[model samples]
Target: MAGRQPRRTRIGDAVVVLGVACGLALVGVSGCGRSGAATGGGGGGTTAGEVAAAVREAADALVDAGSSKARTSMEMATGGTRVTIRGEGVYDYRKRIGRLKVLLPQDPSGAPVSRPITELLAPGALFMKNRGAGVPANKWVRVDTGTLPDGNLVTGGVTDPFTAAELLRGARTATYVGRTEFAGVPVRHYRGTADLHEAAQAASEANRRTLGAAASEFATSEVPFDVYLDDQGRIRKVRHRFSFVNEERSAPVAVASTTLLHDFGAPVDVRLPEAEDIYAGRIAKE
Candidate 1:
């Protein structure tokens, strides 16, 4: 706990943000048969435009699917420590409600810990439960995404289905990776690499967290995408892998995540934790 604590914290923050982005991306919209057989190939048979169109179609379908459950897994390596997170949750984009149970790495005492968090989109707030990390154990801190000092909370736009569609629409080099089975369902895979600058620019205005240099810096890091669509052209899974060097450090941190979307168009119920379960003191942001 004594060596390079701040740096490790930054790494943890980076990975956590990435995990949330991926998780949010997993629960939006759902649709069936949007992908067609006529344009499902990856190599000589498919063009970038076709692939982009397919992605856009799938994105729209997902949005239409309304509510669904998600299972997310993330892995990160920073310096010498490696950590993994597993999460399961239900999200209703139409109603802007979500509940998540995120399993974190073990504590210093070797006990497992987790952040049981929920989002009440009506007021655009994120409620995070305090684990035993110095904060009161019985209270849930409310973080108003709209009031954050930085535009960081707005990064949710990066995971928005429309934003994702816009990003794919700008992809000049997309290829069909061919048809395969994913999660026991037949799917067509497509791979695309978008220019970081263009990808950042393509984010919907509503989803843009910051403008100018900040946005450019976000794009400065490449985003390699692997998109999977079921037989009906409905999106079944999406994976993003990104890596960058921190400041002047040559050692790089890499993050990889995968999100699977299923149980499309399901009815969802998201209730806030009971008042008794919430702490009345000032909520601390973890």
Candidate 2:
């Protein structure tokens, strides 16, 4: 908000440890299992081309719906410890903005480490309050999404709802899993892998640069996902498995991010913090 530049802090750095452990665990488990293949009863006859095309159009479908309430979950596991971060919010597709209250997991002793963080997600920026590492609780820390590795995808812990759906634009391989009910609504499930580079090429102008940054910084450009689409082709639920290199560990970190959209056409009002309300001082590392 202020004209002064905030200290450059990599959001990804705070979550790197969780990523490394989760990535290693995923690799070990994957080696013992069969390839990820679609399984279920509905839409078995749908062709791969048809499924891919339908999945790719899901993002546009959401825009047509206007807005929705969203719930997000991000899980990371290493060794035997698994932690999950949860968020609930509302998003406006037309305006490309949303507000989420994110709760961090409890400490090992089952004690709360901090209060829930309030996050405002906009086109190219992220604003957070109660972020806690030496910052005033009343001030917000703003980060440019385009400057973040993974394009603020895994870096923010909770992937932005709009970006999660837009990622489907790059769907390269897909199989119809079947018909299912999500939040009491009928939906068709599809599973596939998307190329981040291709998604960046097809993404809207506001998201192109952010996603392109992710494509170049992640350990791999390919993202695996499972998505559920309603009758109108709107996304009911989507889950993305992201991998990024943890420089210190010299290994990839794996994060499973899930987003659920419902209450279509819900009212959403998100206001960005004023320049005077933003903290421009140096932020301490987590």
Candidate 3:
């Protein structure tokens, strides 16, 4: 928390995971950002061309701020299903199960892959899906809001919106990747990456010179960026893939939060089991 900015106490869903131990966090955002906009669209005087760049810039800052926290928000549409993901947390050290809160459309009710999806939060790839009904409702594991699979991506949901906006800000110069319609919205896609080599050099200089300079360099550390803006002039989709440069090894991942709350006005409590319960063949982290 020494160098981190004061984060917003978000409700509903935000991609923000705070890694308390390593002092790193991640943030993600949904397609429809909580920009405090009304349901009616096209009121803003800004065009897609003018605002796209700035939006991505805002998203990049959000990601950098959230990486220390281990959180993110990704908007994915598959097979007529619109998934607004607010993800935070990773389980294993090598990146295993991640935590997620999926906001699904209710009118159609449950679909095949209707439950929340978890991905790898540690510096690796991990995603699991329960295709069949073998898994029953209420059987899903419950965990704290700011906690991850093994406690990796906590508070990721809250941070995602900002990250998406920042990435879009940088994407403006990544060559106009053109536009497409996704989920009934016109999307403008742009791609770009952070200069890892330069980032490493700057880090080295800061270390050899002034610690304050090193701290500043780390704050502006670059990472890859991607974005897709919707027709309503909002972020419809985003996938900001970032990798740390000149890292001796992958950084450690941890989860931290003041508390976790749910949409139905409920709370998620993550606690350790008793010794007797462990002996009774009950072991699960939620």
Q: How much lDDT does candidate 3 score?
A: 0.30
Output the lDDT of residue 86, model 1: 57
* Each prediction's RMSD to truth: 7.5, 9.2, 15.3
- Superposed model 2: Cα runs more than 4 Å off: 1-45
Candidate 3 lDDT over residue span 239-266, tens digit each: 5442122122233211122111112111
lDDT of each: 0.48, 0.73, 0.30
Structural similarity to truth (TM-score) of each candidate: 0.66, 0.84, 0.32
Candidate 1 whole-model C-alpha lDDT, 0 to 1: 0.48
- The stretch of ten residues in a row with the least summed lDDT in candidate 2 is 24-33
Q: What is the lDDT of residue 52 in candidate 3?
A: 39
Worst 10 residues of 3 by lDDT: 257-266
At residue 185, what lDDT does model 2 achieve? 88
Looking at candidate 1, what is the lDDT of residue 90? 66
Provide the lowest-lDDT 10-residue window in model 1. 1-10
